[model samples]
Target: MSVSPFRIALIVDGEYISAWQYLMLERLLASPHAVLVVVIFRQSVATTLSQRLNAVLLKVLHALDGRFFSCKPTAQTPTSFLPLLGDVGCYAHGSKRYQTFVSTQRVDVAIELTGQAVLPEMVASTTHGVWRHFYGNPVHWWDDYTNIREYARRQDEIVSGVVRYMAGQAAADCVFYATTSTDKVSINRGVERTLWKMADFIPQRLHELATVGEALFQRNMRERVLARPLSSQDAVAPGLITTCRIALRYPSNFLRKLYKFLFRQEQWILLTTSHGNVTELGLLENFHKWIPPRDRFWADPFVVEQAGEQYIFFEELIYARGIGHLACVRLQPDGSHTEPVKILEKPYHLSYPFVFKHQGQYYLIPETAGNHTVEVYRCEEFPHRWVFEKNLMESVEAYDATLQEYDGRWWMFVSMRSHQSCSPNEALYLFHADDPLSTQWQAHPQNPVVASAAQARPAGRMFTDAEQLYRPSQNCAGVYGRGLNLNRITQLDQECYREEVVSSYLPDGDFDMNGMHTLGIGRGLSVSDAVYIHRRLGRLDHWIGKLSGFIDQLVWKHCYVLMVLPLTFLWLDM
Candidate 1:
């Protein structure tokens, strides 16, 4: 049976509609279950000359480079603009014109995308309760307590300013919804990336809000109203001068990058140990490093002890292909490891070769997200060959597919990102089945069990100690793979899931590395990977490597532009 479409009414600020709001509008129109019935654009009664000039400049820039310069609304808005009095609250109870418009359109749900308090109580009094998009500071108040760098202070202020300018057109409703970030990168490009990344999340979130509004309207209309009212304290207003100072930091950021490139080298993985006790490995001085060959870097190490022999499996990333292949090396009794041999390779990239024993048979589940499927491979020959088995999940963009048996059930944890998302490190999803190899899988009731990147993406294998299970997660707060957080699973089942962070591991010492991300242990042998800047500027190989990398980055960045240039020129000539 098909359900009827829900009518969604949008209350937008006409004089200023942000790119995020415009994207949300487009997403709503594209949704099948929701139809945009009315667009009540609240226009200001008066505007200063400067404001009008800025608006005109924005319109001209959008016409030329709309995709990159998508900061304001365009002439391409789909819905007809219904201009309403901006100061509807000053009127008697509610503006008669606005109330009449709502009543005539029969709006089932009203959404305020322009974080303004221009929404009158009369609108909610007539239609379903109003739901507001509460855009707040990029960095939360709690982030100050973290061990982030000093540069993040100014960057956060700048981001907060941009969010306020774009979203603070009107007063938001009580139930505030916003995205939180703990990233500590201070460069201007980092700030720009964060802002653009958050914009991609608005559409999906708005659709979810509309779905919730529909369910609440059907259940209890009055209960749908937010209990806590929005106040001035809920919003952040960064000063104009401070915002300008932050924007000025962008030119200097290029200098910082150049300095790093000339002084530092590329990041390579370092192998380390923790004796028999993985938790006791606290400081960097305690472990010895295992350096690989010059042409390849090894990372994402997973150790497995079978019978009396121990094997360390990891990703051997070739510099030329820029793709990783599964490699393995035997750990000798003397604490030394043999040279790694490539055991598995595919047309697409692979990493995180999580090996385990199930029913006395060895199996591997490598990170095959590049193939758009999560697959399992059965060991055809010990420590060498693997034959393809059935795919656990297909047609899903997932990464770091970690599997473990817990409480008599096989649970697989993976990170999934939306099609629009650039990083897959923000949403952790779970699937469980009676058998590890079963085709039938059930998604957890609370999908994306963990949403924040700080503790969502799996770093390596999950382990158990003292009757408690702990999962290793990537601490992407400062940057990707900046550190690792060990989270203890307090509660996990089909209905609910919860965890508490037990410990954090950061890279420090003479290695001059930013972070340590992966950790795996088995049978007195603990293996982990650390990232460090590897420089060889004075050497001939360094120049060759540098030239190759430059070409690679250039081609990757402009591949689409190169494809379209010829067609564009041909069309122009015609």
Candidate 2:
């Protein structure tokens, strides 16, 4: 094992690469702990005329739909000039020329961006062989697989991961995996968002290799699950029929957006009850409801009880402000509530007031992702006021950061966003420290420990039931906050982490419940929240907005969208 920086090889298609791949290269090259020792490029062969036409059509739609619907201006380009760094050898992989050049270089680890499985020869040439991205849910690691855009459009989600190919090993090592929601309106947007997030996979692994040393890194890699085996399949360009199907699906997409903007407003309300397993969604209708007015929504409820008095903390977002603020309300014995009081307000959006007790003192770490930091606040006055404590993390888009004490150490669980458009609901990261309020924390070697929309984001504080530690997670699969998953922590330590979903609590169809995320329990008081869909058809505050939104949709989709269709064909291959 060596503590020195790693000598890396960048293997890719020659001359040009996708913009997202270029981003990966930039991150890899920028790392002070990694040095680019050599590059092995495999030039792309020619494609059929139909394939070229398919690419052109995809380019036009991607440029238009991503920016138009997703409002992403800086979409990743399919083709970008590749930066030739270190000793470069643009030779066909596995060829005699490639073998000669690769053998001459002293490579620790190789990053393969050519969308190909690591060949046994390449694995033998390097110390740790190559790391590559594999796609699919159970992971379809096939030689010729469906394009991710088509897969996302068809499947409504994308799951991909990076794996380490160790020399002489039968199975590759799983380093990272993520299940991201697909932008149903725009397949290209979905692909763009997913790739931007997955770009960090290799760079993080490289960092571990450098700092943790090869022996521990390799051992930990093996401790995780093995990568899926690569299967063979025939792939081709999307032909006329597939293309027409894609075009036709947009009509429904337009209708869905129109329905949302015109007739509906996502009004999240909070539900609370005195007792029951809040993890179980049954009997929620019996719980009292805290509905907000049409102008805003109240959600993410965390009820705290002190000295026989209970206070409910939540996020209140007024429509005019378009940002969330921390607010709390005191619960009366007669099941009544006081007027909501603003507790802590910041210029940036804040939600998920993760309040917990540490050594007889109350501390709060809310989701301050808008400021790009996980900030901590200490409660000076019970239930209402707090002072700054410490910045636990910085310059990171971490969400719903929930901290818990386990194994005589403090652990923090959070969902992280790798890129701007990347969803934080897809990957859960773990960090630990000796002190609960410590600014410096050690990240778990295998992060994210779990990567699935069904169980990635922390729903609320971790609690124990029947002496078994349980953590609540949000199922943000098809819809945000669709349900809550109670996961039993099977393993948690400095080197490894694991959890199993013991039970799932989704909205009761009989209760007309739409979604839920947070759950609060302790002091003989248990509380959780649920959302019900409410149409703004009759509300006075939304009637005029409904009419205006209807017209806006018509004008934008029917007129503007149609007008740009022909222009996209003329935008040239991008």
Candidate 3:
């Protein structure tokens, strides 16, 4: 006989919902047999009506799409009351006044995201019980170092008391944990109990949950990767911020610095191709006074020098979004250029113009991150026409890939934020580019050359100056968001590389109070050095984005201040 779908009770303490959790929720609910019961903890009466309605709307949307869920708001209880003696919170007990609510419902499994302090006795005694402690991993637990002291204090209080640990033992028959290493060796020690590798758990009380949330996690990954549309075009958010600023902020900002070092001193010429208000390539360069007739966004400038002849190939964005085709322009020695000539046009979007020559053969590499696969192209005839030769680095998750030839070996590096735990999965993945045309790409045994999501990611090619290699990367540690910390890769080899804080652009000169992300980088004719193009997606990006801050402020104020009205509505609805 086929098994009935597992009934899942997703327990959330308050307003924290990770992208990974959201994706897995959708996947688990994808099975028609499974039922999702979302238990939302309402801590305060001040939450806004709109916020409450939206929360219900979210559950309703999921239910309408085939999920079976209900939102239950209990009283705001303190973590101290829980019987569990662990760092996590407790909420297993029904609200003091809501005993009937627990008696009326049957939860097959109670999966707690990260409210370890709230797992009460009433909540634990449910049938076939299980709880997923998402914060058990070291990588994620230290995402905010500042919260460590506060969390540690709470942990001591819980362990000293017997209720917390005992409640944990009594609540669930099984415990599911996600962690890379134990606390003794790895940085994330003592945050929670890990049953993954360690056998220190009380076997008599809890069985290990081996459900391998892999399938569930993969579904979530696919949704995020496919959600972004392939084509995109926007002005290189203005400013001449140094590479150091971006590298220090976004972890991928170093690519900008490496480029500047390689070509910063040369005098290059400027050639304006199409004049359109929608296009931003030239306006940021002080061409805003005169408006052109054509409304098209051009690709990053492509420069090639051979036998005293320089050729430039750029993309034209026809509708201000879709990348049209490769256009070629001839450049004079003084940096002056001829009219741009359209060369090749493909149905797919393309940008990040990269051109290199080897053994008399010219090749091009574009930011094919949107294609979800890596591909290389060969110049069939110069300027406009080319043909796709091979696809490299298949079945990998990454964006913004750049290739480099170093020490007689070819290396292809890309930025990837892997699936599952999201503590800066943005790391540099290297592959051996055996042949220009062959797709036989081999990953370096140490796959992730750089692990710091705040650093190691590339904004462009690992540019070189005087035989010394340097990379432009983003630095994201310290603050939530602000400016870049341009880093210089002093040394790189098979084992690892060292980066130096060349310069940074943190607001108020505080390195620990800002963040930055690099978008693109390349060598241009106008300047001798490699120009790294970047954007500072600071806290302003979040607080100013689509009224998100306003919505959050309204929600918090209303939910906490005017709770009686919504409570009445809920009581009536029930």
Candidate 4:
């Protein structure tokens, strides 16, 4: 294929990072292309972790640009105005400076990989294409066929306001967008019906995928119904086969609740550390080795126990990338173990894989969090050849779903991030399954049981020590991971569940105060136990941090004084 070595200007938002962005950057720089990046950092220098992370990102970006293809990254200072013009703090003055620089910088294409909404006027002057690194489908508050249309309308209004800001500016020649599943209609429909009417919708090399969406929607319909609780259907309710057929035909809305009723259960006293500080709370004694060094990022871990062996499934994040694998190791009866073995690795990130054995068959359910789908895999030779069977849930902006079987019914609790805001405070959805491993999932009418970000994220599997079920949620009260606040699950079916923080671990003055790995429960040959692991940046990160500090000092002494000192005082007087 005859291709052009495009000159691309990428405006990146530092808030969200995904594998897609990393992969796209690799493609752009690997080819015979030129890229100028204007990175908008959302960090204020006041916070410790934020400053350190931003510094590391700066160093990494600098190294990448110097070593890789023709790439230049210019850090843009955020725009700061007196807090009241009703201006959503999207772009800054330094961003304006970079934009003006790009206008004359011979850049053919400008791609905004940050999921933030940008106006066409921002790149109307560029000759090459303008693409928005859109993630997920444009979700509306209301559930209706016209949802896409409404989303399109809002986008047009927002973009038009931005266009008016750039008077007489010509629109982009072609616009690029990343599509989402189910919302493919809404996204494309809105784009073609609205954005296209404004500018030509250009097709790009990277296409949107729908594998997870299609799989989840198809299989989950059957799985959800089987999971629903059987109530007093009373006089002449729908038959089981007919109800299953209808459920399979018309799946429940992912946002809707499937069941209601709460059951009080025991407490899961999990102990962990954060930011290098080690702290263990609750009945979580003899579980201190699980905490990792600070400077590493870890997520909630899932645990599984089968055949007298305990295993912990966790997300190993190295440098912010998800290491999707079912990390397994023997959890000795004495709460001691060997190093973890890389059990299973999915093509995409594999995390929170809830494993269980049913009638000599080992079934694994992994949360393909970013893929927007969940899948079940059967072990061909027990933890070796795991063939993909079906998806349990799909086409929803959800994460960290944990499945539980209670009162002869299987229920799944998940935190749904609203597509409208991509915020984590949205309600939690509960799904009931006739069979725990089946594809039929029914939604609870009261859907979102819990909607608070502070308690929404699940730490791991909801296990039953005796005959009761308990939910483990991340108690991010102080610093994000200072400690986990344990809660007793009081209800499950009626959706009237409440948690009282019986005990929690607090930071004990260590590097762990800033970061912590997730906590998990596992069982081994000798005894059943819990396992925890986290990633910590090597000492090299600290040295680099020190170096960056030195560089900042030098810049403050030389460049800062030379530029800002003279200009600032003069401008202040003016």
Best by lDDT: 2
lDDT values of the candidates?
A: 0.59, 0.72, 0.41, 0.42
Model 4, global lDDT: 0.42
Residue pairs clashing, model 1:
115-170, 116-170, 116-171, 117-170, 117-171
Query: Across residues 207-237, which tens digit of lDDT does each residue of candidate 1 receive?
Result: 3335444353232222212311112332233
Question: Candidate 2: misplaced stretches above 4 Å?
Answer: 70-75, 78-98, 115-120, 137-154, 164-175, 209-239, 277-286, 508-510, 536-574
Model 4 C-alpha lDDT per residue in residues 524-557, reported as the tens digit of each score: 1111113232214445544544675575455433
Error of 4 at 487 (Å): 1.9
List residue ranges in candidate 3 displaced over 4 A.
Answer: 1-294, 395-398, 417-427, 445-457, 473-486, 501-574
What candidate 4 gets wrong by more than 4 Å, as runs, is 1-286, 290-303, 318-323, 332-336, 424-426, 465-468, 476-483, 506-517, 523-574
lDDT of 2: 0.72
User: Positional deviation of 489 in candidate 3, in angstroms?
Assistant: 2.1
Winner by TM-score between candidate 3 and candidate 1:
1
Task: Rank the models by TM-score, top first.
Answer: 2, 1, 3, 4
Could you give candidate 3's per-residue lDDT for residues 170-242 as a string of tens digits? Answer: 3321122212211111112222212111211112012111121324323322332242212221212211121
Models 1 onward score TM values of 0.70, 0.83, 0.43, 0.42
In candidate 2, how many Å is residue 319 off? 1.5
Which 10 consecutive positions of candidate 3 have the poorest summed lDDT? 155-164
TM-score of 2: 0.83
